[model samples]
Each structure stands twice: as C-alpha cells, then as structure tokens.
Target: MSGIIGKKIGMTSIYGADGRNVACTVIEAGPCVVTQVKNEATDGYKAIQLSYDERKDKNTPKALKGHFAKAKTTPKKKVVEFRDFREEFEGQVKIGDKIMVGEVFKEAEFLDAIGTSKGKGFQGVVKRHGFAGVGEATHGQHNRLRAPGSIGACSFPSRVFKGIRMAGRTGGDRVKVINLQIMKIMPEKNLIVVSGSVPGAKNSYVILEK
Candidate 1:
C-alpha cells in the first residue's frame, strides 16, 4: 500500500460528462522525497518514509537534522511512512529519490485518503450521535427538546450504563476515507482530485494510498 504524503488544497466542483456539477476535493500530492527505506532485517519490517512540505532549518531539531542529512534533503514539515509498500516500487527507489504524484499513482483508479478530521469541540447527542432527542413537547415536558431523556436502568443497574452515546468531545480524529474515485489528475501541478469531501482543514497534510 505505497502512498504519498500530500496537502489538502480545499475542495472544488467540476462539470462531469453527464452535464452535472460533481463535487471533489483537490489534494496537492507529492513531489515528496524519500527519507528512509526500511527493511525487515534492519528494522524488523518493511516501509517507505516520505518527507513533504518545506520547513526552516533553524526550527528543526538536531536529531532530525542528522536524519534529513542522511537523505541529503532540506528540512520538511511532514513525514509519513507507508508499511509493506507496493510491489511495483520495491527495490526500485532509494533514499533521497524524489517521487512525484504522477509516478506512483499514474494508473490508479481509486484512492484511500487518510487525514485528521476537523475538530467540533464539545457537542450534544443530537449532533454527535444522531440521537432523536426527546420527541414531541407534549406530556407536560417543557423546554426539553434537546434533552437526552433518561439514561438510568431503573433499580437493576441504578447507575447509567457506560459506552452510551452522550454529549462529549467530537471530531479531531484520524479518519480514513476509502474508495474515493479519482476524478482528475493534474500532474504538472502535482494535484489529484478525488470525489467527495476529504477530512481535515484546508492546507492540512493527508496521506493518499492507492
């Protein structure tokens, strides 16, 4: 599952062949540098680490400076590793090699995008868990439209059951959206447009797997 680390360049809409406006998320994929090529004998596993986005050298730590020095590349803002890389690229690439979006995903028909979802802070059950908050306002219930009703289990349990969907923190999680159709690929711009909304905010880094 070899992939590239990219930035989410927001979303856009393009007209389809059927004369309908199709929504898509534009991602600036690759132009990434291979920082590390791991092997089973040396690291106990196989993986390819890619570095993307430029960062100031002064902000980078001493240990990271040495790591990037081995790759002979400048400081990067983001680095992601793909485990059990695709067979096509196995033994073909090495550290310091530049991998473009078009090279690895040229024939890819679909993609899996991994990113951090937008944080929604604290939310109620209705918005967070799709709970149908107390029905009609009848039965002498006043101003309880968005209430979570009763959570107790009478005398048997007395205490509210755990794992019950309730009001709490929401979003800001690692989300993997699978089977996103590849709508377009702008190789020159190093961008890949995938159908549907991608996780994370604009300019956030994402991992594109095919």
Candidate 2:
C-alpha cells in the first residue's frame, strides 16, 4: 500500500453542498522526504522509507544523524517504510524526493488511517472490556457494582482461563480506521480533511494509506 505520514491537526465541521454539517478530522499530510530506498537485491526487499516532521540536531542520536545526512535532510521526528510504493509513484521516487499530500490523495477518495490510540492507563473491566456491572445495588451489593463476576468455575477447571478478559492497561495500541472518505484537500496548507474521527490525540502522527 502507498501511504504518507501526517499529523492529526484536531477536527472541525464543514457545511456540505446539501446544507448539512459534516464532521471531519484535519491532518497535516506531509511533504515527507524519502530518506532511504531499499531494494530486493541489496536489502532483500523493496520499500521506500519516508521521514516526516523535524527534530533538532542536539536531540538526534549519532547513528540517526548519519542516516539523515545520507538523505541530505534534517533529523526527522517520524520515519516509516512502505512496500510497493514504486507502483503508485511509477518508480520515480528516489532518496531525497519530497511527497506532498496532493500528490498521493485526492478529494472524495476512500483511504485508511493508522495510528496509536490514546492511552487511558490502568483501567477497570467496566471501562476496558465493557463488562456489565453485577446487577443492581440491592441485596447488600456494596462494592460489587463494577466487579467482573466470577472469572472461572470452582474445581472444574481449577484455574482461570488464559484468555479471560481482565482489568489492565488500556489503549496505546496500533489501530487502523478503514474506508475514511477524504472530504477535502488543501494543497497549500498540506492538509487533508477526512470524514469522521481518527485514532490518537491531536498532533499525534498517523499514516494515511490507500
């Protein structure tokens, strides 16, 4: 799949031609720089590595400094590789080439957005796994409201199941939202407005793919 790295620039509602307001997420889909090009002969695979956003030289590691120097670009905050990019780019994209938002996506095109969901830290089963509470608060049920009722049977299994849903860390996982419609494209601002919401918080990086 061909994709571009972008930052979620919050969201807004725009009035459509039918006089209906539609909610959309604004993303700053780059001008991403081609940092590296891998080939089947050398790297054992074909892929194009793209770099987006900028980082200061002082904060960049020594090894990454040389890596970005090879591409003749500044240290990037995010780097991602996409296989089969040559088919979409017609085999013209090389190292140091810049890919803009308008070049990859068009208005009204359906695409997929991949991003890390917002972390909610340690959470209970009620919020994490959507486990319903243990009935009403009657019958002297003091603290059993949000508790996960009986994980395992008595001596039948003798132990809790491995895949049992429990309270634990939530979110902060890679999530893919598919078939998002690109409602508008602002080439000058390097922004693409996609219908509906995307994962992650505002300003977080996301991959928009087609």
Candidate 3:
C-alpha cells in the first residue's frame, strides 16, 4: 500500500478517555511534494515519488538542483517512492503537487510503520548472540564471566562450525512493526501520534504504510 515518508519524533505518553496513559511514538509525517509521478505506460508501474524536508539549494549538487528544478520545487533532504495506491489516486495528482498528511490518511488508525532499528555497536556474545556465558558465578572461577563456552568437540571436528553465533555488530537494520493504533493526527503541525513504540532512534526517517 502507499505510504508517507516521516521522521520519528521521540516518544511520549498521553491520557485516553478511559483515564489510562497510552505510550506513543510521535512522528512528523509528510507534507511531501510529489516530485515525480510514474505510471504503467511509462515506468512499467504505478507509483509516486514524494520529497520531504526542504534543504538549502546551495547545499544540493548541481545535477540534483536541476532535478528539483524540473518539479519546480525547492531541494529536499529526503525522497522516497510509494506504490499500490487507492483508485482515487488514479490521475489525481501530478509532479510538484503538495501532498499533506491531511490529504491522504485523514482520521487513520492502526497503521504499519517501518524504520531502521537503533544501532548497538560491537556487542558481545552475552548481549548480541545470547550465550549462556561462563555457566557459573563461583567455584574458583577467575574471570570467565561472559565467554562463549565450549564451541566444539575435543578433536572430532577440530575446527569451529561455520554458522556459529558470535560477538558482532547489532541492530541498525530495517524493521517493520505493524498494527499500531493512531491515537492522534495533528494535520496543522504535520504530526501523528501512534499508540506504542517504533523502531529506530529519535529524528530517524520512518515510513508509515497503510
């Protein structure tokens, strides 16, 4: 389904009608400009390329400046393509058309969100790979607290297995968390509050899909 490009604006809790606080992820959803409109007859698919977050023209490259010039719009910090739109989108828009959050997902709830997860750099076996670690706390054990115990048999295999879980980089990958209830949509401020936390750090780019 078609979606809007957005940024995760931290998290906060709000009270509901039931007098209960609902944890939510506040996002700055698009007031995106339709940079390019693609169709089956031309691009072999029906899709819209939306540009969000304005940037200074001087900061943008000359080639990209001309690209934005074609749309008759200012340079943008990010651009993304969305496909599988509703039938109402058929020939309804063109390049340089501004698509605000109000235009598309008005009064929407239960949306699917996608973003890159927070990066946990250089994690160890106990944290990253979830190893048992050392197995004991005492019994004259010196300092084998967080080690991967017994990787292989004595001499049968002689070499460690290929697919063994070990310490490495963690997180910073694309993640999609779905079925989150949209508690509020502040079109005036181009903000959306959804019930529950989403992947990624604050100010990171996120995609909200139907």
lDDT of each: 0.91, 0.93, 0.88
In terms of lDDT, the poorest run of 10 residues in model 2 is 84-93
Native-to-model Cα distance after best TM-score fit, residue 24 in candidate 2, in Å: 0.8
lDDT of 3 by residue, 1-210 (tens): 677889999999998768899998999998998898889998999999999998997799998898889999999999989886767876998899888776667554678999999999989899997787886878988778998877788788888889888888999999999999888889999999988999999999998888
Q: Whose TM-score is higher: candidate 1's or candidate 2's?
A: 2
Using lDDT as the measure, name the better of candidate 1 and candidate 2: 2
In model 2, the Cα lDDT at residue 117 comes to 100
Clashing pairs in 1: none
Best by lDDT: 2
- Between candidates 2 and 3, the one scoring higher on lDDT is 2
Off by over 4 Å in 2: 17-19, 86-88
By TM-score, the best candidate is 2
TM-score for all models, in order of appearance: 0.94, 0.96, 0.91
lDDT of 2 by residue, 1-210 (tens): 789999999999987667889999999999999999988989998888999999999999999999999999999999999887737685688889999999988888899999999999999999999989888999999999999998999889899989899999999999999999999999999999999999999999999999
What is the alpha-carbon lDDT for the whole of candidate 1?
A: 0.91
Instruction: Give the root-mean-square deviation of each candidate in angstroms.
Output: 1.5, 1.2, 1.8
lDDT of 1 by residue, 171-210 (tens): 9999999998888889999999888999999999999998
Model 3 local distance difference test score: 0.88
